[model samples]
Target: MGENSSPPDPVRSFSRLAVIVQLMMLAVVSAGWAISDGTAVAAAGTATAATAAVASVTTPPMGWASWNTFAAQINYNVIKAQTDAMVSSGMKDAGYQYVNIDEGWWQGTRDSAGNITVDTAEWPGGMKAIADYIHSKGLKAGIYTDAGRDGCGYYYPTGRPAAPGSGSEGHYDQDFLQFSRWGFDFVKVDWCGGNAEGLNSRNAYQAISDAITRASAQTGRPMVLSVCNWGNQSPWDWAPSMSTMWRTSGDIIYWGQSASMDRVLANFDSAQHPAAQSPGHYNDPDMLIVGMTGFSAAQNRTHMSLWALSGAPLLAGNKLTDMSADTKAILTNREVLAIDQDPLGGQGVKVAEDQTGRQVYSKVLSGTGRRAVLLLNRTTSAASITARWSDLGLTGSATVRNPWTGTDAGTFSGGYTTTVPAREAVLLTVTSGGGTSSPSPTPTPTPTASGTGAIRGVGSGRCLDVSGSSQANGAQAQIWDCNGQANQQWTSTASGELRVYGGKCLDVNNAGTADGTSVIIWDCNGQANQQWRLNSDGTITAVGANKCLDVPNNATANGTKLAIWSCNGGSNQRWTRS
Candidate 1:
């Protein structure tokens, strides 16, 4: 009996079949999306020509950068060592692609004709040689530069002396073109010099973006642009059109030290502009500080889970050449990584928080009624936390699986409850919540109507009014005292615009789709950006971007501006029409 096999178990066979079917469905759906966009996708399977050059960018980038650990001490030998270790240490196979040489790689050196030059001493075989080496290892190469005339190597200068004009201030096009010519696949433009010179963030980054575009065109290779302005000027509001990712906050950990949990939480909070994120665009929370010296194993787990939940770029900042087995295991956990790289590109939001420092967070996954839940306990004592189905927009019972330990935690009705250890977290994926889910508590189809009414905010108890009651085309929408005025009156038109003043439609300023895009009144032109849908969930959604009308920071003050953000079931997004 030990060596002989009986008939296959029906349950096991069914489970295997289900897995296969799910994988097939995913491949089919993903491919359809990419093909519809006229782009090549790996899931398409047959378009080997287009698929190879332009794989669908549906997730935040995952890679390793040198700044947090090696800082300005990096050189040709240093990069080679890390690049080799990235492959040998299993990081390369784990979807860690870019080996970024952040800052310090170059000093202010330009030859005749205003060309940026890398010192042969530091970059021995030239910058292109290292890029070729990284590509040889089947990974992408990332280079760094400052927006103005100085960089960290010139100001903060770690292990190197200050070198004037170490940035790309006067050479945006030339510098980016040089990076592309040298085979760099990514570029992180820092704001050190820009800030020093009081340069306008928008103007400066826009120039860099344009330069990168020109470079990509010239080289026939697109480079991922990382706008590293540290969230100043709220890059989430406009950077999506220019860069793949923008830093939402300052560095999680300094160049040479371990990061604190508070810093992690702060950075996480800063990057929660969920409305701004989409496929190929992300709000960066700086690089990962996992496995660093200061954090304990539990803390490390929490850090990873939070970042993964936020759909942040999973850039490793630890020295890969020497990592403990535990660190490697935590870093290489595929289940957690899958959440970070979910194809849907949804950001997790805080659904509930308590007095004892406990919180429940939820993220809507790709499949029906599937959700990712995080039970975080920030208190010093262990606490039992519950994830409510109502809060998650889920109904009835659901199956829960712990991604960290790879085990099913059974099913429960209404919600799931578990005791999270102090200062740690529990990450579980909930699926197949019994019955159906509604975007709201009661399912009501958005009816087509010509009726006019004053729209009030559920959270702020204020009326949505045109700022200053201005009739100008770009007048901003804001929450003000409820008054039966024409400015507060809105008609939900059949064509989807919430029209006021008869001819002006609520528009996304300049038809912007990024997070924090202002909600304003503009001349009705029947554009998708001006279209609105009054949903059953009590939220007004911008049809084109599929974002909700939201009060910035949930402010209850009068004159609080309104914007469109990714719907997160927040009261700030709920509105009432009467």
Candidate 2:
């Protein structure tokens, strides 16, 4: 009879079952989306558009960062002293403007409202005061944070942990606002506990980027975002829109007393990504280890030269106040700086390599046809490295100037061969026509062409080539061996432009009507100087000035520069399309 009574309570049983279903649904929603611990623990959405109010940094920032030298032991007094040293040491005048405080600047906990507070024990006067002092000296201030739930490093002096929930994970907006209010000009966001949280790197960084944009609007301060994820997740693929610079390698350790050679080589490999380099967005190979004790004088030179040629941000990690003359010389070379600061912003490439541990890296300077070459000998003993003019896109003699010595190493023709010590590099600027020019005496057969072929000089039989096969503006058009390279290929465009390399037009330098003006390859601006007409008599005439394209001195030798001369119907002026 009792079992039968249970059947009578069927309606009640259904009601209980409905209540259980509702509870399960509520639990699911709570677990999926809930703000916990004053941080956004939920997954991030797509990145928002960068704010227009904030201008993108057009060059790699030159500054001094704390983590490399001082690490977590940094304090207000140390930063202030460094700022003062920067000025007295002439570093500030040399363009090292930002004074940065790395990790351990924050208290172990955020306030009730999730706002981060400076550790009063280390920063007795607070961070704003420090920023103010730095600004008074005409320098900017930078601060660091982590993207994880807990920071990466601990404060060894205080014996305190990187406070839990102190990172930008769930509190990006709050922390960004706090950083802005503190007058920070730069923010370095690291990925410490981020991966442990199971967060996607792209989403996590985009969240911080959005917060930076929002905070910048509220505070009206332009903050340079430095992505310091140690090059994980290939930040170069996506960080340009969000940051001014990014780390492409791990922390450069002081291997011995100077920069570690292995780390330097790693950075060189990272710099091979050409598309990562641009105006304002730079490929950071970490700080310059020039003044550290572990490296020799030769290693220091190699370190600085590679950083400059690679377009890396030159953040001096050494103690500026106690630097030696040699260290200062390595760090403050204006000629080296010129290559790093060139307007072209093109990272140098490894143009030549050999099994003997010798390599050549080359970069084209903006506005000048000069090429900066670094001959590196990575072997344990001295090695001879040869840089053929052909490999460097030059055909004639070039004056080799050593920027480090501020003196010319004399003009070299054909090729410049030098012996470099082990673990050292030779930095030279190869400029066309600065050295003695020797015309080739060998007679080349007259080249024939029909369509889209090399424009062979009838007098020299050498093909018209873009110096160094360079697609850059102002690259000289010169006579070289007809090798069927795209830089030597020419085709008449429908717009009356003699185009090469797909779209660059054959241009008369500066549109000058005067004789002896060099010919160059420039963007198709539809300008008169870029317009040319191939006449029936196998002569290419400048459409604007009506001058004939002639080889200098009617030289039938390779490496002869091409120019616009008076149309005299000479063989040097005769050019076959093939």
Candidate 3:
């Protein structure tokens, strides 16, 4: 055979060897790519792997949302324009990053494979394309869905019939995956359909949260879940664990309008739930109506100031494309944003209110002795509002800086007083002297106990003890052995506060009316939940919810927890003074 074709075809064998090596290299690259993709997914999914995810936002997100302006008029084009406007108008540089499409972006039906689809007519380029455009502008994209079968704007006239699969009720996992696939960085889960479906607020929010976590795990994308239940269920009690921010009031209509004050006041009241505000989870008071025409420049400043001081999400709802100079200035104030973005994450509180409709709100800022104070004039005419340092837990003099004016308002000791125009606010940062200081002590509880002694649980024969003798707020009040400890000693105050553990008052957690809601000691906020009336019949009753303090299960165990329950006149509900 001619020596087997010259022993060997060296050239052909070399070519074959080269092809084999290339194939091996390609396989190795493919494996590496797969591993890299898997690692990215793992990191993104880790934020939501557990039922209760740690907060993703260290500060409330500053952004622009479509609901307050466009409502159901949102579409791919509108969002794209807003994204472009955000960049071109200097808002992006001012820290406004999110461009959220509020509602009406879904098709009326899911695909045969049970996948949610966008309204092709409205979003001709599709949500993914819109998200890509937003990302190109270095901004995040957000979308809206209802927790139930329909979103709040599901029936809004968007020139199309309402979508059948518009919400995330039975399709939470599917919708979450679809949103993640579309590159949505945020989701505002509204409650209209869910509330209509008779789902409990807590359970419904938790389910969607778990589904989002799973979807994030699968898609390798982190999504901010905003709970939009309109504060109907006191979401502050449970939404913190599940959502980045929860709406604490109904929609804010127009800025500085007479009727909008109700929404603002409702939010301010809801923000009083201090337990709900944290680094990752914020109490949303709804979108900012800052640039709207109805409000004056001063009023707009007030709106921005309050939102910032309260640690509420500052999602500007105005048209970014044509914002006026004054509006831009109000929205872009860096110093005010610093207070809202403070790491302390404390929600500003209504510390003082006067008969003239003047109110003072205060929040402790990040640094020691640094506080943000707001003097609000809610009246029809201009009035002088005062902020007492002691009311804000500050004793010594503080250098007051007007954040809006960018000027020092001089140092003040006892308090600061300023004239705020009607329906306006003065925002100030009070920086205390660097010396070591302490707040004026809380007023000692006056002994007003009619019975003047230990409150003994009649059936258990144990004393009501502050769990662990902890003086911290929200410490559970429970029955314990009669140790004659300070925690077990109780004195009923004239103001109806069950003063125990020094200044802490016996409180019904969240003013819960339900059976088995924990009884804890909280700061006396003069809320009805902290008020109690000692009945002549030897039973103690919560003043507002009208529930009696009863030991859970009527058990006589030493550590049985005390809760507020219906007044059935049970022996366990009775309290006797020793």
Which regions in candidate 3 have their CA more than 4 angstroms from the true location? 1-54, 155-160, 254-259, 354-356, 434-437, 440-578
Greater-lDDT candidate between 2 and 3 = 3
Q: Tens digits of per-residue lDDT for model 1 on 1-578?
A: 00000111122222223223333434454554567655534331122232222222557888899888887889999999999988998988888999999888888888998887888988878999999999999999999999989876776877789878999998998998999999999889998888678787879988988887777778887888888987655676667756778886667777556668756765675576565665566778889888888988778889999888888888898888898777887888899998888886667766655432577777666777787788877667999998777666667788999998999999888778899998688888888646434332222233322245688889999989999978687899999999876678775533355666544568888777789999888755546787676666687778777788899999999999899999998999998876
Per-residue alpha-carbon lDDT of candidate 3 for residues 1-578, written as tens digits (9 for 90 to 100): 00000001112222223223322332332343356433212211122325333245667998998766665667777888888988888888988889988766775577798887666777777788888899999998888888888765554434446655577788888888888998988999887787566677888988988888888888888788998876655666577767888876556663224325434543454444444565657878788888875677876787788788888888998888889999888898989988888865666755565542577767777566677888877657999888776566565788999888899989888778989887678899998884223332233212222422478888899888888877678888899888865577664532355655323568889888888888988754546787786775677888777888899888888777799899989889998877
Candidate 2 residue-wise lDDT, 80-127, digit = tens = 899998898877877788898877677447677877777787787788
- From the highest lDDT down, the ranking of the candidates is 1, 3, 2
Best by TM-score: 1
**Which number leads on lDDT?**
1
Clashing pairs in 1: 275-566
**Residue 518 Cα positional deviation in candidate 1, in Å, after optimal superposition:** 32
Q: Is candidate 2 or candidate 3 better by TM-score?
A: 3
Worst 10 residues of 1 by lDDT: 1-10
| Cα lDDT, model 1, residue 232 | 59
Candidate 2's error at 554, in angstroms? 63
